[model samples]
Target: MDERIGLRERKKQRTREAISNAAISLFFDNGFDQVSITQIAAAAEVSRRTLFAYFPAKEDLVLHRIADHETESGRVLRERPGAPLATLRAHFLDGLERRDPITGLNDAPEVLALYRLIMDTPTLAASLLRYRENGKQALEEALRDKENLPQLTARLAAAQIMSVQWALSEDNYWRIAGGTSADDAYPAARAAAEQGFDQLAGGLGGFL
Candidate 1:
């Protein structure tokens, strides 16, 4: 029974990866707005229903990985060993050092192309906006009892913190997109991240 379950999980993973690869190839060749779900299904050799099962939305075919880190801020606030703000700061700084894609510091050719594709495509940008919004709300909930602050203050703090990260990441992406190597951009990324979090903590001292 355990073997059967493991086999089933492996098959599911393969299907998901196949779908993502097919959809991305199609999107790369034909541009995002010009492609349809049926076309992607055909390219992936999966029925439209199966494709939807693996990914609820077509936009997710390329952006699913980005969604993975969206909940991290909430987790930090909820399970902090020290100051929640400090934990969040350290987490992003770690991403910067590691050249995490979410931190927009990855200089790999494929990563740059993928980032450009998202920026050039309207639907993907909108999907990313939704993801960021969801992350903000999650952080807000996490911050509710986090600092024992007023409700309005919690909401404001969440917004500010999320915005800081977003702002720094966007700046990094722009630099990389403009031909700056990720290594060349590392200093700015690290400085921006540190300053952003420091400003957040300074402005809202409850969490610090």
Candidate 2:
């Protein structure tokens, strides 16, 4: 049973990677909007039906990772045993420290190019906005256990958290776009993220 499950998981992971890589290659080669689901499946050497099983739409081929991040926020919050704000603050700060590529603070040229591709594509940009909204909603649900908060407070807090994270990500991206090396971008992004988090901490008692 264990072996079977492991194999299944590995297969899924490989397929996911294949789909993502294929979609990115195509998106960078042609354009995000120019690519179609059938073309992505062909590139990945998978049937269109199989691709849909992993990703319901063509956008998922590029946006699956974002969806994962959205889902992960809720997981992190749920697993946190301490103060919610401190928990999230530390979580994101750790992500910054690790120079996680998703943090957008890294100077990977390819990554920057990917960002530019997303920016240049209307469909990708729209998908990104939807992903952000989904992330906010996920966080709100995760934060629902907080006490002394009125209804809608969870969503309000989630909005604030998303705003800070979004700002930090954009700052990190801009730092790289300004021609800073990855190493140089790291500290600057970290410091900026820290400063932003500090403001949130002051306002929300370390939750920001």
Candidate 3:
């Protein structure tokens, strides 16, 4: 029974991936606005109903790639040992070393293409802002629950951490987008993350 359930889950994941890949390919070739639900559904060989079952909105077809990462900071804080800020700093640095897309240190062609697509589309950009805001709220809850911080303190810390992280990611993305290789940018990216976290530690010294 468990084996059957696992197989069923894997099949669902494959279907989802096929639809996402087809949609992204179409969006990359013809602009995001030019792609339609019916077209993507046809390309993926899935019914429009199946596509909607997996992804509710047109924007989700693209944004789903990043949805899993929205609560990463919260998870890191809850799961990792040691100071919250230090754990987050270490995680960000590790992501840079791994060329993780969430850190914006990835230089792969597909990653860069997706970044360009998001930056070029105002609607996608707006959706990303909302996603970031949601991430901030999740982190705040983690701080309040895990660290036993006051509500206001948790809120402030989460905002500062999220802002610093976003700035670091944007800087890394632009550096790679503007011609710098991820390898070449690694040293500076590491330094910036260290400094950003250091500043955070100082500012939130009492709470963190």
Candidate-wise lDDT, in order: 0.86, 0.79, 0.95
Query: Could you give the candidate ranking by lDDT, starting with the highest?
Result: 3, 1, 2
lDDT of 3 by residue, 1-208 (tens): 9999999999999999999999999999999999899999999999999999999999999999999999899988999898889889889999999999999899999999999999899989999998899999999999998999999999999999999999999999999999999999999999999999999999998888
Error of 3 at 18 (Å): 0.6
RMSD of each: 1.5, 2.4, 0.9
TM-score of 3: 0.97
User: Best candidate per lDDT, number?
Assistant: 3
- If scored against the real structure, what TM-score would every candidate get? 0.94, 0.86, 0.97
The superposed Cα distance between candidate 1 and the true structure at residue 172, in angstroms, equals 0.3
Which pairs in model 1 have colliding backbones?
Answer: none
Model 1, position 172, has a per-residue lDDT of 95
Alpha carbon deviation, residue 120, candidate 1 (Å)? 1.0
Top model by TM-score, which number?
3
